[model samples]
Target: MAAQPSSSVFLETYGCQMNVLDSELVQGQLVALGYSICQTPQEADVVLINTCSVRQLSEEKVWSQLGRLGIQKRRRKELIIGVLGCMAERVGATFFDRMPHVDLVCGPANLDRLPGLLDNARRNRGMQLSLAGHTSRRSATLSRAQDGVESLDLSRASSPIDHEQGVPAYVRITRGCNKFCAFCIVPYVRGPELHRPPAQIVDEVRRLVDQGAKEVTLIGQTVNHYVYA
Candidate 1:
């Protein structure tokens, strides 16, 4: 049988260390799915933007980038433009109306749903928006309980996904936030706080080191509040 052509993804990230870590996780998963990481959007079959909604400025930047990517999507008819992470969850189905060029709108909670969503997008030749984490296939409705962010689990064997070689990498040890300070929107956007397994964290750190990462910064909304069990 003839081999299939490998796909390429160009992932752009914005906001805090959590966003950087989220991008890394997305890249790792995509690489495993026979997709190579591309340096530029023009060279990629898929273009994913991991966004932040922590502040008004950050949200504005996300919208601006979406507008810009929409322009590029127009130029490249086959290009699959996507928005992931916080912004996707925040905007939900509204993103497609605002930027019809976006082929996918997946949330961090729904990262595992990307392959199916992309497949659906290609088959329908239209947008696939999966802001709600795990939707029922039969009902085609979102499970409100599953709409929370999925935390990094370290138990799985990883591929040789080198994101920032010979550079400092942001390693997400924890996810979400329980304490919703009056000024903070993390609790709403990220959902409840969850601590990753210590063994997984250690394994991820070792993997990062082997991948030429000089330094690894453990990140979370409240690093001090991490309770590994």
Candidate 2:
């Protein structure tokens, strides 16, 4: 009998602590389903490039990384590529009109739908997208990290080592937001805040640490305002 091959994955992320935490969530989910993390895009069977939409330069950097992946996909047709997190919600796959090679767009809320989304993308050999956001109120309390998470930085590029085990994992304890700061897009896009519960937050943190994560960050607008009582 022939032995089946294991899937290898690589995630390249650019943005805040929330985005990094988002990547860890994706990583955790993927590993649960039997995928091993890869160090480089070239060494991956699946490559997920998570991004941020808070800045124009960040957008530029994401496109630039995707540009290199487009070349890799050309040579490796079976390699699956995905753009998850904020950028997925922010830009969708429009950045790929010229790219035409992206395999999936997982988005922020749709990350939990990843395996299925990737399956569909593979079956169609076309863009698989979902930036519609989650419908559950748990999205609010589901904090990726109640402790705190950092914003993204487009200027620096993380090496494979940085992503080897992934930096501080994020554990979403909340979702959506009422705050619509001028020149920003949280309320308009994410809606009102939704919390997941303190117990769940603790559980997520324990799970993260069990998986080799040493730090955690809570995600949301005004994350400090969260109340346990």
Candidate 3:
């Protein structure tokens, strides 16, 4: 096995093509911030789980994953663990209170906050003698908007890192949902429908193609409702 780098991340995602694409974007941004993607949880300086809340079972699995990570965090005080995506938005700040080991809890729309939060975690790791009672302090703040719907604020330059060199990739062209069906949780967790600007989407696709992506899948909860004109 190859030696782990000085700064590394282990990111895992659950549910949907959107979540996978979201993870890719996050990995790309973190890579730009000088973090390499590690293969396992044990080899990473930071571990982020991008969760889903489409069903009760999915959330349960996330909780179980958190329990496992909590054990690892107990052994390594400096390890940064975070929960992101729909589940994080659904639970909000209470997730920090519930899982004291987590360094941050942020929604999909708030991924821009990760770089700053991770930096804070690293800087405070050695300064604090005991993190026994400390929990992630990030709050879910909706600060950006487009057409009255909140923006997801994803990075446009994040091209997928395909192991096959030329595989199909998913692009999140739209996010959230407006229609709240009785059995669905998307609208609650992901919020209202927010479409990405056509220019930005075009640029991202072009970059992905340049990076050897053969095909692209545009993802959204209500893909039929997309109106970027």
Best by lDDT: 3
Question: What clash count does candidate 3 reach?
Answer: 0
Best by TM-score: 3
Off-target runs (Cα >4 Å) in candidate 3 are 1-5, 125-160
Model 1 RMSD in Å is 5.3
lDDT of each: 0.70, 0.65, 0.71
> Per-prediction RMSD in angstroms?
5.3, 7.0, 6.6
Error of 1 at 201 (Å): 1.7
For model 2, what is the error of residue 199's alpha carbon versus the real structure, in angstroms, after optimal superposition?
2.1
List the candidates' TM-scores in order: 0.81, 0.75, 0.81
Off by over 4 Å in 1: 1-6, 132-165
Model 1, 94-187: lDDT tens digits are 8889888888888766777776776676566577877544332212112233322333334123433453556677777666677979988776
TM-score (C-alpha) between model 2 and the true structure: 0.75
Q: After superposition, how far is residue 80 of candidate 1 from its true place, in Å?
A: 1.0
lDDT score, candidate 3, position 206: 80
Candidate 2 lDDT by residue in tens digits, 127-207: 787766544223333344332221111101221223237665556665666667898865544445656567767865675
Error of 3 at 33 (Å): 0.6
